[model samples]
Target: MSLKSLIQGQKPLTISIISFLLMLALVIVIGLFGGRHIIGYLEGQLVAHGIDHNQEVIAGMQPILERGLQDGAAVSVIVSNFQSFIEHAEPFGIRLFLVDRKAGRVLADSQNRAAFPYPLNQLLDSMPRQLNGAPIHDLANWDGNAWRRTASGSVELISLHDLVVPANREERWALGVSSDLSELLVLMDSLHLHLDVVLLITYGLIGLLGFLVLRWVGRRYEAGLEQQVAERTRELEQAQERLIDQARLATIGQTASVLAHEMRNPLASIKLALSGVSRSEGLADREKQRVDLVLGEVDRLEGMLSQTLDYVRPVVRDEQPVVLDDLLDKVLGLEEELLSEKKLRLVRSKCPQCPPLRMDREKMQQVLLNLLKNAQEASPDGGEIQVSLEADDKKLVLTITNQGPAPAQEVLDRACDFFFTTKARGTGLGLGLVKRVVEEHGGSVQLGSASGKVLVTIVLPTAD
Candidate 1:
């Protein structure tokens, strides 16, 4: 279609729809990018603040620590300085502890008891490395959320900004401050939530504007489209008439039901008569054999009649649990003569764990019968037909595969659609019925052709 026609034909609302989608995408992209940058900036600030606070704690304790080491002061005097440091830095949430490096034991802690065993991964920096070398500047590690460890072995946060000391070369001790990074994270989180809210509001406004624009555009275009459709109605009817030229198919579904009721009584009588003849003692062995053959053919006719009736008069289900194996057996009984005539074998490898499923038994059996009959017809004369069942976390599956020349792709595409059939005398309602019944049972049916074989798969939800 030309761009002008596409814009003006049928619905003028297309313009607003396209514009709204573009604006919605833009809003999402902006929110995502904005949230990321806001979080990054907040993290950077938190890291900077954490590093500065550690520098102060290290500076204050440096002179006292060095004097204690040089003068060989008792642990009591060293701990006094530690307590003073903590008292001064209390607002910052800084805690200090002295460790015996060789023994890995705490000597004096700001809390008036031995420090808890340090977690190696949580350790930020080694005191020996800081003191034995040039004075260290700021260093910190993010412990995620509000927990951040600094160069000095202390825990603190932005609330303790006053305890931060300027970096000094004279400092000899290392400091670890566990800063509360929550303020930064909280700020970042707030920004993200705000951005999300803004995006939602933007989408709502855009949708409202687009709806108004479309309504206005539609009001302007509706009269013109109605006039055009009225003018071209005759031409469209001619095209449809040419397209669906098969008159017989157009009436098959409707006529099948009407003819079925009339045909069933004679089919049943023929089946019953053959059954009685087959049971009677034959005058000769050859006669008996012919009688059995007649009985078999009668059974096949009866089955065909059943399929027609089922198709013509479909029954909507009040679904109930059906034992799959039992249902399959009943369907197989209906198809036994056809299977025998073709010398086709039916093999079942059903998982023992497969539970019963909720379905319309008659409809489900009809589906199975249709699928198997199709398989039987498709296979090479005397070939095998395999029916396998398995279950997953949610659904039970059944697959029927037959060896034959796979169907052409073009024919396969519309195989399940109503009135689409491949056979010369086919009613086309068989697979269509199968599709409808499976769908009504909350299941799906699939047909695939591969490796010179046709496969039909039916997936049904497991029983409650």
Candidate 2:
């Protein structure tokens, strides 16, 4: 795969790994440089210790040599005394040498005369001229078997050269001491090894822990994204179903509009013929009653056709302030005959505090008539229908309820759905039309079965 694609595909895991690798690299670099710095510091301390040891040696031997010289001891006697002192003194892998400046020869050796490789004249000639009253020190690496008895079978040697002048003497002496650094070097190597092991273990553990944490977080994030995708898919499916339902409703509305228009002329012709038959002198009383019944059915069909047309058409509202009690009284007056025919009692309850509402007068009247008609039709013989109006905050609430067989819960839920009905002769446009009108007036409608009755509540905004 291309580098960019690979990086993007596994972005989180890749980023975590890259970060961890960088940290590990940083740690490794710091360990290396820090280790070298520590080693250098230790080596410096060893060098300082060697210088101190050389000074101590010089201080101890100087007084003894001066005493021998003041007693007029011979040169051989002084050399013998120095050798005896060296034999009795502590040996910390250090060897001392004495040299005569005038004779250009080694006077005495701490290890052995054979251990001195170069003559005193050659050593003095090679050294710097200025002493500055301080010993000269040098570091040398020795690879010979002469240091086989030492710690590592090889040695780092520190050499110090000091100039000594005796009282009443024209000759000067050179005192040299050499110390081995093999043991210190061994300790430094062990320290470095241990540091490397610890650092490696620490980095390994940290990298492992980081990897596990990243894996866990990645899994959780992936699961969350998957859940979101599933939820989105479900929402899309529901939206698609709604779109299908709307398409079906649109087709039904178009067909109903055309059919209602086509039936109107024929229905009018039939009604005219039925009216002429009822007025004829030759018709018997029974025939006339039958004709009147047919005329009533024709009128009912016309009303249904008109309602279908209204359902299909858009509403045009001319809004104005309307008093709640006055509007209810008008609708009830229109429904008076139907209520009497069904033997249903009307009970009106008006809250004195009810307020005027802003609505289209014609549309609001139609909504109240439809609701009252539904309550009349659903009520049993001598059943009471209750109509109540009250003001709630900034709105007017109206409720119409009747004692009747309660509608099924499912039917009540879809009571406002277009063309949905439980009644055999229902056009199914009454409640739907009421809902449309109320909504157009910035109001809401709800239907429910409660307390052994079907209740419909309408809320409309009050005028300021």
lDDT of 2 by residue, 1-464 (tens): 89888778886767877877887787777777777788778777876776677667877777777777677778778888777776644376777767765565667776664543345544331222111223232212111111112333645343344455556776566566656667787887898788677777776677677777777887998999999999999999978965865675577688777777788889899999999999999999999999999999999998987787666555565555678799889989988998899888888898777766665677678788888888887899999999999888888889899998998888888888777888888878888888777876778898898789988999888753
Residue-by-residue lDDT tens digits, candidate 1, 150-262: 45433334211112222332212233344455555666678778867876787668766866777677776887788888769977885675355334334654566555667
TM-score per prediction, in order, is 0.39, 0.55
CA lDDT of each prediction against the hidden true structure? 0.65, 0.73
Instruction: State in Å the error of residue 205, model 2.
Output: 11
Worst 10 residues of 2 by lDDT: 139-148
Q: Candidate 2: deviation at residue 272, Å?
A: 2.4
